[model samples]
Target: MKVIHLHQEEKKIIEEAVVQNRQAQHKLYVKYAPKMLSVCRQYIKDLQQAEDVMITAFMKVFVNLKYFEHKGSFEGWIRKIMIHECISYLRVKKEMKFVEDEEFTHEMHNNIESQFSVEAIQFLIDALPDGYKMVFNLYVIEGYKHHEIAEMLGISPGTSKSQLSRAREVLQTQINSLNKFNHGTI
Candidate 1:
């Protein structure tokens, strides 16, 4: 097995990229674009828009490359940029509309657990509204707190909590529907 000195290699690449080396910048882009695009898509819901946001974020990454302090994982920094770009794009498009719905039925039916494929999961998430999707992705997937989500999306903590609850309610309903369909009960 070939041992890779990841710290030394990544440090060297980041150092080069910081100095405005085209190859190193290209390397960083190529390494993180796919994941960053997925992050963008989680918010934007349009493949073309996600790609555009990823490219835009990459440009910002390169422009602000000198500010990276190397105190954390480089990919985390890039992901934050992509996420911010996605939020900014959504804001400019006027697509993020949060509804204040506090009436939540926090219950699951049939007590049946079903394994979901990635495509099915994405489909379920894709079916959610923009506000719920954002909250759900941030709170559930990204492991952020309600207050953190609220601050990121410029809303109140209560709004973030409600959005997450609503997203879960919708997803649970969809899952139940899928389960019934799979069991030939639909």
Candidate 2:
């Protein structure tokens, strides 16, 4: 039940820990773990796996803490590590295999807007089939280009685009359905 106050003393303790004080290091981990765990949970579907990933990611963060200049937020640095860990975990899991199908090339639509509730959008994302979810997460949420997604997932750029398009269509359909339901109920 520790309150995370980013006061001068807290920052000084973290800086001291980065300079090799074991107690401050432990305190830093205790202070940051809850926040970092929440970030890990968003990227990973399973709770236990999220905890494992966070643990490993924090270890890496602690090891590299000395390299952290005050250039960015400390939380942002930890977030990047957690994200990389999640990517590695997903890559190893191979939950969805990426296939290159030339017939499924996607043409991007312009200026699409969504006014759905956050819960509705999350529901749609969670409902997506595994392959579509992975590609959508990487390309849309993570801001990865199709070529990079193709390289990372062993799929063709066309397939990456197609998957993203399909994911969007599915999401839009979900939103429409939810909107209809809302209108009907009201």
Candidate models: Cα lDDT each? 0.85, 0.77
After superposition, candidate 2 runs with Cα above 4 Å error: 1-14, 19-23, 26-35, 103-117
Clashes of each: 0, 0
Q: Quote the positional error of residue 51 for candidate 1 in Å.
A: 0.4
Model 2 residue 2 CA deviation in Å: 22
List, residue by residue over 67-164, the lDDT tens digit for candidate 2. Answer: 88767677778877877787788778876655556666355565546677765566678788767877887777668798997887678888988888
In terms of lDDT, the best-performing candidate is 1
TM-score of 1: 0.91
Work out the TM-score per prediction: 0.91, 0.71
Which residue pairs in candidate 2 collide? none
Error of 2 at 112 (Å): 7.4
